[model samples]
Target: MRLAEIPLCVWRTRGQTFLFRGQNIRYWTAGQGEPLLLIHGFPTASWDWHYLWQPLAQRYCLIACDMLGFGDSAKPVKHHYSIVEQADLQQALLAHLQVRQPVHVLAHDYGDSVAQELLARHHEARAAIASCVFLNGGLFPERHRPVLIQKLLLSPLGWLVGRSFTRDDLVKHITQIYGPQTRPSESVLDDCWSLIDANHGTRIIHKLVGYLPERIAQRGRWVGAMQHGDVSLRFINGAFDPVSGHHMLERYLELIPNPDTVSLHGIGHYPHTEAPGQVLRHYLAFRQQLQPFKKIACS
Candidate 1:
């Protein structure tokens, strides 16, 4: 179902607003017990977790927010959409919610890099991330393959392209990332386009795409998180994703020590959206394996 069709009552009851860095950050939380933070990837927001919300909330306190430049959050015309900054915003949100316990992180695409940063912070005793589950993300910069559109978005000439980017272009790039079998519906594309244009975000596509280089520059820190962090971690991949699909998985196994992976053969970049059941089953199993000794206290 499209985000717009999620029923007004659902949004009214679960939707929330928080203040972060002088911006109105939109967030949502539900269920209770251990805390679980959900982070979205590039070009999307918290709505990315709509499929896992209820099932996950039934077990843990699910916290998700639109990062500075996407979703319902304020999109500043000249802001640094750095992954470090995104990670900071998430920490701030947890603080604002009075969540003091360690949280399990579920991140996708661009969110994967943010999650790695958070994990690095936890390693240095700056934050608390009990575990992490990475889905179709560029965890290994050298192993990633950016599509032609992403390359242009990262180039100096991106400003010219961003200014002319249209709904059709958005759908094209987005649909291309998904496997052919699970292409997004027209309605879903419409909703995503609306979210992208929520605050003239389309005009700042170049700025938002800045995360690509930041990923490469901060490669040591992020990759180190997966390689050495004491926390439990797993990579759930959609093999069909051309961007960071099976190729990334190959690199992950090579670099990471005793890594864990769940590959969905036919799924694409958006396994959670395309194969929610499989994603949920794998996630539930991962959580169960890392089941905390006791409930995390949030006061």
Candidate 2:
């Protein structure tokens, strides 16, 4: 299966439909039991969880979504997919999905950042997030991407990424993303390009790159989530991640309290997809470890 299932983005949810703040975004979900919401990062959508759905589905109600702009969700030009806005959208989406209890988030890349925003709003989220598995998108921007592309997208240089989508650039980046476990296939590159191309994917290059707005907005919330003791956090660090280098895990620990950090030897950024079997085995074992939170004395 693909890292994430892309076709879901194209299909709208049947029962759940609500306006988030204002933007109408669509998410795909399946299964039953406690709600498990999976959010994908940039350049990819809910497809990231394609391989994870089955194993996870057996345990909890699984809901994976294409965040507003990136996935096949509604893509309105100028829509600020910023953190605050996405937080509002996420609440509305959950409400529409009839999600009442706290949800466990399997977040990566921008998705993890979104989870950070959610934790800030609903303090209960800290306790309810059965676990958040990080796959190297650099949630802690200090050690993550932080600047560069964000500056470009926000500034004049933005036009460069916005207007350009060369076959080589797409291949190089996609290929590089899977350097550790296995090489990214051409189909994956095609799907990514399709997502970018599905809608003037190239034009939004700058706008999508501009996702820093969401990260910047969540900076404070990340700190808040760290201080708050409700959430259970763990890191599946990709040993070979260059961009994140050695900083992501440390920063993750800073905010996540006594986080359980695991090392995926020789893996790059996309651990879930790169070493699905390996990740799955470890994740299952991690889930079995028992831990209780006193902070979340049930109301």
Runs with alpha carbons beyond 4 Å of true place in candidate 2: 1-24, 124-131, 146-151, 213-217, 254-256, 290-299
Candidate 2: tens digits of C-alpha lDDT, residues 93-196: 77787777877777777777777777766674333454565567767666765334445567876767667756567676556545454766777666666665
In order, the Cα lDDT scores of the candidates are 0.84, 0.64
Off by over 4 Å in 1: 1-13, 291-299
Worst 10 residues of 1 by lDDT: 290-299
Write candidate 1's Cα lDDT for 1-299 as tens digits. 22213532355357788889899898999899999999998888778788778878889999999899897789988777788999999999999999999999999999999999999999899999889999999999998888787889888899888778888998878888887788888877877777778888877878988888899999998888778848888888999999998899888878887777788888889988888778888888888886322221110
- Cα deviation in Å at residue 191, candidate 1? 0.7
Candidate 1 yields a Cα-based lDDT of: 0.84
